[model samples]
Target: MYKVKVFVTLRESVIDPQGTVAKDSLHKLNYGEVSDVRIGKYIELTLEKTDRNIDEIVKEMCEKLLVNLNVEDYRFEIEEVVAQ
Candidate 1:
């Protein structure tokens, strides 16, 4: 089996309103040292062994469904795992 960790984030050119809000709130709460905050999504997926290329599969999934190509960028890490 394989464990996949997908990280999706807004492109640097895109403004992250939610992250900005969180940072502002933190500053208001006296966390003055925080310079900036960026929010992102983490996704975990488990797949059974397959003949298909794992990297290609993951990239296809991310591009087709998991991420918005226009505004968001994504990267993934794959780890081999033993099924219980």
Candidate 2:
């Protein structure tokens, strides 16, 4: 088995309205020390062992469905899971 951790975030050039709102709320709640806040998505997937390259599999998933390449960027880590 394998465990995949994916992190998806808006491109630096893209405006993050949700992050802006959250930061504004934080300031109102007396958390002025916070400078900027950015929102992103985290996804975890468990996959069965396969003959194909893990990196290729993950890249396909990200390109096809997990991430929107136009406005979002993604990074992922894959870990082998030992059977107990």
Candidate 3:
């Protein structure tokens, strides 16, 4: 079996309004040292072994559905797992 961990985040050039709001809120709550905040998505997927290239499969999934190519960037890690 294989386990995939996907991370999705806004591109550096893209503004993150949600992250900004969170940072502002933190500053208001006495976190003056907080310089920045970034919000992102983490996804986990479990799949059985397949003949297809795992990297290609993951890239396709991220491009087709998980990430916005225009404003977001993504990365993934694949790990082999032993089914219980």
Candidate 4:
């Protein structure tokens, strides 16, 4: 088995409205030093051993479903599961 950790975030050129809203709210709550905030998604997936390369599998998943490539960027880390 393997564990996959995926992170998805808006592209640098894209505007993050949710992040902006959160930042504004923080300032209202006395967090004035918090100038900026960016929001992203973290995903965890477990997969059974497969013949395909883990890297390829993860990339495909991210590109096809986990991210909107036009506006978001994604990264993933994969590790083999060790049974106790």
lDDT of 3 by residue, 34-68 (tens): 99998999999887899999999999999999898
lDDT by residue (tens digit), candidate 1, 1-84: 999999999999999999999999999999999999999999999999999999999999999999999999999999999867
Candidate 1 local distance difference test against the native? 0.97
Q: What is the C-alpha RMSD of each candidate to the true structure, in Å?
A: 0.8, 0.5, 0.8, 0.8
List the global CA lDDT of all models. Answer: 0.97, 0.97, 0.94, 0.94
lDDT value for model 4: 0.94
The local lDDT score (0 to 100) that residue 21 gets in candidate 2 is: 99
Q: Which stretches of candidate 3 lie over 4 Å from their true place?
A: none
Candidate 4 lDDT over 6-43, as tens digits, reads: 99999999999999999999999999999889999999
Model 4 residue runs over 4 Å out of place are none
lDDT value, residue 72 of candidate 1: 99
State the TM-score for model 3: 0.95
Please report, as a residue range, the 10-residue window in candidate 1 with the lowest summed lDDT. Answer: 75-84
Q: Which stretches of candidate 1 lie over 4 Å from their true place?
A: none
Pick the winner on lDDT between candidates 2 and 3. Answer: 2
Stretches of model 2 off by over 4 angstroms after superposition: none
TM-score, candidate number 4: 0.95
